[model samples]
Target: MPKHKEYTILLLSRVTLKAHEFITKVVQSNSAFGPCPEYICKCGNIQSDICETATVAISSVYHQVFKTKTKFSGLEVLGFDKTIITDELLSDLPFRPYNFQLGILRIWIVKIGCSNEITTNLAGPGFKSAFIYQYNKSRALFFQEIDKNHCRVTIYYECNAYIDFIEQNPDLVWSKIGILQKYNRNQLFELTNQYTTNLIQAAQIPYCTLNEWNNKEIITNIYNYHLKCCIIANINWYQFFCNKFEQPNTIIELRSALQLIYPIEHEIGERKFRAWKAMLKNVGCSDITPYEKDQSNVLNNLIRACMHLWTQRISY
Candidate 1:
């Protein structure tokens, strides 16, 4: 049997002290802490365990994919997209199998408008309009800002770390997602919840577990559903990786980066790329193959995609 290591994902919302205060005042009251989450009922470990410090100033997932090298190995990025809070827009940007990074940090709940209104942290279909009604007058101004320009609020969210978040932190705030069921709990959190619970069901609990619904079938879901996303998302993520913020997916990027590590002095013509590609495959990139030296469409597409997305990263 192949050796499989236990993996944990941590999702965090980064916010300045100012944004933090605003969110606590506005959305904090939105959720009432439920029962102590079972994942961590006896999980002695704390949030500090696996959750890392949030990096400052990130804009697009498109950007992060190309902006940097990862500090850690065996890690991969999921996918990227900005959030939409309004009712109609929310439907297009549903929360099922995905989530919104609420709280402050320039990104707050969906706003009513810039005239000074608050927004609810509601999920799914009603997420947008419902969020608007939840706002108070003091916050009405910001809502207008969101509505008028469609300015992006938060940076981005990833799939893997999201699950780690539940492992490290209580899924209390996350659990409220069930309420969105009326609107089709089709949001991404449902899978996340299941991922967390699956671990508990096995009784092979970790020292610390997230209170979020366990993803008992994380392996199945990830292999069947999430892997397709990662195959493209991660590869695209790597081609766009930034040398500053972080490297691209170490897991998959290694297949590309490792190319340089190998000796590549085969005939430098049509077979040159083929030779190099063969070397890479030997290392583990079974997906790679040789291409015409003049204008390799595959490699060209990869670079083009990476450049397009990396254009928006926050330069240090």
Candidate 2:
């Protein structure tokens, strides 16, 4: 059995006098709230945008994967592209499974991204490891106004931990496989606590001076703003796929579309080349063949395929 911990932080008069207004302002400003690639959601482009972005920035998954440590022990939780797991990109795992791996691919759905209840799920199709035991875990956050000058925030995290293995297999040793129950449990607590506290402290800052909010009222899509920041941070690969899209699938045609430069141009080494192929494959591109080179059908498919990732992410 694994442990599930819940943590809470209640900031007293430390918060702004205008609880809802201050939070709204913080949500709109990049300096106050940041977005991580772990969880991205956009729907209707409404008031829920800041909530989604704040939720993502303060999530345990974001802290554990991006802020605290990229890799656990020696295993790389983030794949070659360093993106979080979405329902779309599950098939292209960079490495084969180990006996036990924790937090391999997780999704956090917030506000508009979910229905019924806001939740996060750790289980997905990418779990190809030799299954002996497993744990499905989730952490959720709640916000409240304590008073005119205060706020209350709580984080509830639990794990539906379980295992699956053949009892008759004598060679299956738990000790040798490196289980992450205790390690993950402890790390989740630390990261969740730190992230919550940081958000509180950041919100308490005097940021209203950035710009006066007149009677007209200002509106900004914080979730999309942070998402754009993340995309810009990874713009190279983001643009790479964007550019390669719709072009002929042939290696030469794709190369011309990319207009590769310097080391990448000279060094289409095995790793980089394989990565390109994997990226295309992840985007629903069919198997490329020499004869398939100028087919309009192939071109159309490629165009649609390139938009695969974007369409999944764009505001609905």
Candidate 3:
């Protein structure tokens, strides 16, 4: 193990390592930053304003303190939401038998809002998300719950999705705090599904069927294009089908076509199926009730994974 440092610590995922490393920098700090103007937030319901984030960090083991500036940005990221605040609970947080926490602990004063340049008193529009820095590393984590000074809400769903992405694309990953709100939930899910869809072209995950793909050459050529458009265009699932099938252009047609692949159970699941289609028909599929949540519980795990990835990038 290397010598322990101040504002930072190495977060090791149960590597088969014999020992661990801890390094720290002068802690405590403050700053203001923003999302690039070129980026537009486009959730179906809420078009997020351009977000400007401010972070503050006070480093120490509860009350006894030392570094300040080193903890600045680390503290601010948590403040991005009310769910991530940090106080005493972080320092005294319970640990699993397999996990180890290293830190002087710290406090966060975060301000979150819809514009890098604009200011407002509205919340949920933004928050004071809280975070914790491991004693010898820059990687900071959302303070898990224990007390009010440390109210870390679990958003494991998004985090897990992020991890699945980086694990699949290990060489490089980039994250912006609370930026997930900028995308439509359905869009993000579709993007992930598309990302997975493309993996087939490079090296088909052994044993997985390319189930309904009719044209292999088309799939290979459009991989990168599909990825780029998924981010850049204001497209949705219906548009995707129209572009691909050149079939009919109604929700009925789209639903009917997709059902051919993942067919709706007619006899057994009549009630659920009726509810599912009724929701879309009445409220539009994009306005569907938390499809991401209903789809899988692993969504929470993905959110946690994303947080771990974020801390890894900036912690050093």
CA error at residue 264 for candidate 2, angstroms: 7.8
The reply for model 3, stretches above 4 Å from the true place, is 1-260, 263-288, 291-315
How high a TM-score does candidate 2 get?
Answer: 0.20
Tens digit of per-residue lDDT, candidate 3, span 1-316: 1133222212211111114211122222224553221111221232222223221112221112322334334223233233433432142222211221223323342432222111111112222333343322334354222122211233233333211112111011113223334443222222123332242232221111122223444433433333332332332323442343343222233244334544256332444344334323222122213354335211112222333443332221
Which candidate number would show the highest TM-score if scored against the true structure? 2
Ranking by TM-score: 2, 1, 3
What root-mean-square deviation over C-alphas does model 1 reach?
A: 21.7
Give the whole-model CA lDDT for all candidates, comma-separated: 0.24, 0.28, 0.27
The alpha-carbon deviation from the true structure for residue 18 of candidate 2, after best TM-score superposition, in angstroms, is: 80
Distance from true location, Cα of 222 in model 2, Å: 23
Worst 10 residues of 1 by lDDT: 21-30
In model 3, how large is the Cα lDDT of residue 83?
A: 41
Model 3: per-residue Cα lDDT at residue 54:
22
Model 1 Cα shift for residue 87 (angstroms): 27
lDDT of 1 by residue, 83-190 (tens): 332332233221223224323212223312112111211111212211211122222211111222122111112322111111211133224322222332212222
